[model samples]
Target: MATVIFTKNLERHLSCPSQQVSGTTVREALDNAFSDNDQLKSYVLDDQGRLRKHMLIAVDGSTISDRIHLSDSVNEQSEIYILQALSGG
Candidate 1:
């Protein structure tokens, strides 16, 4: 099971209080996490279910390019990190 870690900014809406979760891929875990906290779905993804422009997902330290396809497979030992990108001058 892949372990998903959410940034502090995302902790508020998480149903499970832990910083990490277990799943087989970035998408599956995110789906499970969002299912538990539907309110957070809109915050993390766009109306098209794509990673919002301000959000990013990395697997085992490698950035994911297909935000629309969150079902990308991940290994049990992989570490998934979800964070919001800050934009400004």
Candidate 2:
């Protein structure tokens, strides 16, 4: 099972915790992580289900390749990290 961890900043705003879940794709892995927190889903994904612009996902130290569908593969030992993207003017 892959492990999903929300960054400290995100975890402070939301209550999502690090979890080990089963999935083959990034979407599936995230789905398992969000299964208990629907509110977190809205923060991470938009109405169309694409990753929100303010957020980013990294799998095994690399940013996900498919933001539109989260089709990036996640193996059993993968470590997935969810983080809030910072913006500056």
Candidate 3:
């Protein structure tokens, strides 16, 4: 079971109260999170189910490079965080 922490922006759309989740891989964890909050799915991913350009995923504080194939192995103690990247000056 991996623990996933979402930013305040994401929490507002999620049905679950806690930010933690349990899954074997990144995709599974994200899927579970989205299941509880389908509204957020489109915001973080595109129509093709690929990570949007403005979204970023970090595992244990490290950014992931494989956005399309977000199948990283997760552990019971792993921490996953999804954030919407800010842009424009």
Candidate 4:
């Protein structure tokens, strides 16, 4: 199982605890993690089931490239980090 960790900033909005979920890809892992928490899922993904513009995911220290499908691979020891992207002008 992969360990999913939500950022502290995101937790400020809602209670998103770290979870150990089973999956071989980022999407599957997140689906398992969000199975009981639809609100957190909504916060991370858009209506089209795509990653929201402000949401970011890092799998074992590297950002994911397939935002729409979240096809990035993961393993049992993987650490998946989910966070809101910061932007400033």
Candidate 5:
């Protein structure tokens, strides 16, 4: 199982705890994490099922390249981090 972690900044808005989920891709792992929490899923994804512009997901230590599809691969021991992207100058 891969570990999915949400930043503390996002925790302020909802109940998001680090959870271990099963998946080979970022989308699968995220879907697993959000399976029980539709609200969290909405916060992270838009109506088109694409990653929201303000959100970012990183596999291991490198940021993912496919935000729309979240096709980044993950291993059993991979660390997946989901966080709100900072903005402004």
Candidate 6:
């Protein structure tokens, strides 16, 4: 099972807890984690089911490429981090 972790900033606003879930893809792993708390899902994803503008997801410390479908692959030992990206200059 892959471990999904939400940043403290995100955790402060939403109750997204680190979870150990099983899945072959990032989307699957996220969905599995959401099974425990669906509210967390809505916070990270928009109505289009795409990652929200301020949100970033990474796998194994590398940035995830598929923001639209979240198709990034996940392994048993993978660490998935969901972060809130800072914007504005």
**By lDDT, is 1 or 3 better?**
3
lDDT of 6: 0.92
| Strongest candidate by lDDT | 4
Stretches of candidate 4 above 4 Å error? none
lDDT, candidate 5, residue 14?
A: 93
Model 2 lowest lDDT segment of ten: 29-38
After superposing candidate 1, which stretches have Cα over 4 Å from the reference?
12-16, 19-23
Local error of candidate 2 at residue 88 (angstroms): 1.5
The per-residue C-alpha lDDT of model 2 at residue 13 equals 90
Q: Compared with the true structure, what per-residue lDDT tens digits does model 2 show for residues 21-74?
A: 999999999888888888999999998889999999999999998999999999
lDDT of each: 0.75, 0.93, 0.78, 0.96, 0.95, 0.92
Model 1 pairs in collision: none
- Pairs in steric clash, model 4: none
Structure candidate 5, residue pairs in collision = none
Off by over 4 Å in 2: none
Q: Which candidate leads in TM-score?
A: 4
For candidate 6, the per-residue lDDT at 24 reads 97
lDDT of 3 at 89: 88
User: Would you give me the overall lDDT of model 3?
Assistant: 0.78
Instruction: Compute the lDDT for candidate 4.
Output: 0.96
User: Which scores greater on lDDT, model 4 or model 5?
Assistant: 4
lDDT score, residue 30, model 4? 93
lDDT tens digits by residue: candidate 3, 1-89 = 77777677866765434456778878888888787566788888788878899988888888877789787777788888888788998
